[model samples]
Target: MVATKGGDRVSGMIVETEAYRGPEDRASHAYGGRRTRRTETMYGIGGTAYVYFVYGMYYQFNVVTAVPEVPHAVLIRALQPVEGVELMRACRPGRPDVSLANGPGKLCTALAIDRSLDRADLLGDRVWIERGDRPVSAASIARGSRIGIAYAGEWARKPWRFWLKGNPFVSRRDGMPRHVRAGRKAGGGA
Candidate 1:
């Protein structure tokens, strides 16, 4: 959930995520221990937000998952609306509910996330993950290659992307295993 400066709260179910292991992962900004002004936040303790701008547009939101200096982060790829749907709609006019936060960039737009939120603590009131009513089962979690990182060579093929099986909100469905696509589970459930 995210509470804006205006006091409107927006929340979602994290339907998709992609892990970027640091140092050895070529696709990671912190690969080879390289650090810069933009990547400083990633070195913080776990639960820190590593928000960054990409492609001259779009701010991508990531959760720093590693201990200090390790730099591992998970990119929040898609979310299913859980609260403040109307506010999200206004932020992303013309999009249907399902499309509102189906990608990293769109997720940021719908949730009003940006570089301004960089290094924010996920445990803070401004942004925090809530426990959903129903827990997702491990059997229903599907893994695949990270998207849009073909430049990472062999590292791009890592099965780091994880999403609920058969979730429409997942950014890309084509690479999912055939068995997962054929499963009976659907959105918001395992």
Candidate 2:
């Protein structure tokens, strides 16, 4: 859940995530230990928000996940709208609730997240993560290669993307196999 100063509140259950490890991971903004104004927040203490603008348009939101000085974070790839559906629809006019936040940029747009909230504390009132009811078991989670980063070379093939298997709210389902969607091995499916 995140609340903007304008009093707009959006809440959702995170259904997809992508992990990036700093310095060593080519897919990370902090790769090679590069420290820039934009990536500084990623090196901060865990629980900080690392929001950045991409392609001169969309803002991507990430949660700093490592202790201070170690840049590890998870990109919020997709979310299941739980509250503020109308507000989300307003932000993404014409989009159905299921597709409103089914991607990183869409998630930000739906929740009104932007560079203004970069470095904000995730435990603060303005933007925070609240515990939600357990919606899926760990075994139901599926791992896959991160998306849209083929330029990262071999690093792009790493299975760092995690999402709830069979969740319609996940960003993309094209590559997931039917058995995985069914929460079973290929041969185990009835």
Estimate the overall C-alpha local distance difference test score of candidate 2: 0.88
Instruction: Give the Cα lDDT of each candidate.
Output: 0.87, 0.88
Q: Candidate 1: worst 10 consecutive residues by lDDT?
A: 174-183
lDDT of 2 at 183: 48
Question: Whose TM-score is greatest here?
Answer: 1
Off by over 4 Å in 1: 1-5, 174-190
Instruction: Score residue 166 of candidate 1 by CA lDDT.
Output: 84
Q: Estimate the TM-score of every prediction.
A: 0.89, 0.89
Q: Write the per-residue lDDT of candidate 2 for residues 1-190, one digit (tens) a residue.
A: 5656367667889989999998899999999998999889999999989999998899999999999999999999999998888888999999988899999999999988999889999878778987878657789899999988888989999999999888899998834532255444457535
Clashes of each: 0, 0
